[model samples]
Target: MEWLVSGLIFLHVTSGAVALVTFWLPLLLPKGKQAHRVTGRVFAISMIVCGVIAMVLASFHLTSPQWVEGAADTRLQLGWMMLYLGLLATVLVLFGLKTVRNKGRHHLYKTTWILFLHGALALLAAWVFWLGWSQRELLLIGVAFIAFLMVPGNLRFILRKPVAAPGKLRREWLYQHFTSMIGAGIAGYSAFLSFGAAMYMPTHAFNPYLWTIPTILGVSFMMWLSKRQPRYD
Candidate 1:
């Protein structure tokens, strides 16, 4: 059982590292190019792999608390947080990839599975919020607030018919793709900083603010990127 957890952790860290590196490649490279597409695909797959492993690890933490080296309540809280993050990462990457694939065809993107994913996240966000409020955990509350903001926009994007011009529709897809992929990067970096880096550093030396650094930087960059309308070639 210990070996299994270690193996999952190893895979999760390796894949997350790959994702963090590749997440920037597509943005740095010329968009719509072959290299950009290949790197983007790699990043998306890495994120999915990492997210799945996280969910599995979370399950172990939740169901087999004896294996986890923490207080029972702490383990349970961490398990739920990990599971939420895992689902968030998976959904973001899939949504980003789907936007690109369904370019100009918004209807194709509004599948039942996508809707279900959003719904699940929404419910999870509320539960996390409640948990955070009850426990007075600011991080979980902040995360839930962000989730609340995101899920609605995603749902609106899928449900709303594209009444705009064809070019506008294309741009909307590009924007969503950029936002979702970068958002996944933010999650990846936050987890690494908060959890992975903490493992190496002394508990007292680790600043909780490190968790918000990625989010602030990522969101600022995303906003700047959103302003520049790149050609959707």
Candidate 2:
């Protein structure tokens, strides 16, 4: 079992590294070019692999709650975090790719992979928050709150009538792709920092501030890039 866990960790980290590196190439290269498409596909596939591994590992930890690396409780906490992060990463990448392939057609009302996962994660997030509250783990509570906030948008999806964005250009999908891919980038960076950089910076390594820095910077950059890009309408 331990060996299996180790192997999964290796695959998860390796794929995450590949995702982190390849994701940048698409961002830097000219859009609509072969290089961009190749790199973007590579990034999406690697991230999917990474996310799957993470979810598997999280399941293991949640079931067993025992680890060679940390206390059982700590392992469980990390497991929950990984589960949420992995879910977000996979959902974002898949949706981004689907949006591109759909030729700007996005329907929120109909059942979709993302909507299904989003609903599942919303429940998971509440459970996580309750667990954190019981244990008085502030970091877990904060993480759960962040995760919970990701779901309210689904209300818009289910409650409001499905309507494609106005205008022939329909640039909404591009913005979705940008934000989703950037979101995956943030997850990859956070995982690297938490697991990889934490080794070198033992002190203050697990600080929530450190984990959130990538998200802050990524969102800011996404906003700036959105403004600079051409609009659909």
Weakest lDDT window of 10 consecutive positions for candidate 2: 153-162
Instruction: Write the residue-wise lDDT of candidate 2 on 25-138 in tens digits.
Output: 999999889999999999999999999898898888688755535667767777787887788788778767866886444454345656787777778778878877898866
TM-score of each: 0.92, 0.84
Best by TM-score: 1
Report RMSD for candidate 2.
Answer: 2.9
Which one wins on lDDT?
Answer: 1
Q: Tens-digit lDDT track for model 1 on 37-78?
A: 999999999999999999899898789977887677767777
- Model 1, position 10, has a per-residue lDDT of 94
RMSD to truth, every model: 2.3, 2.9
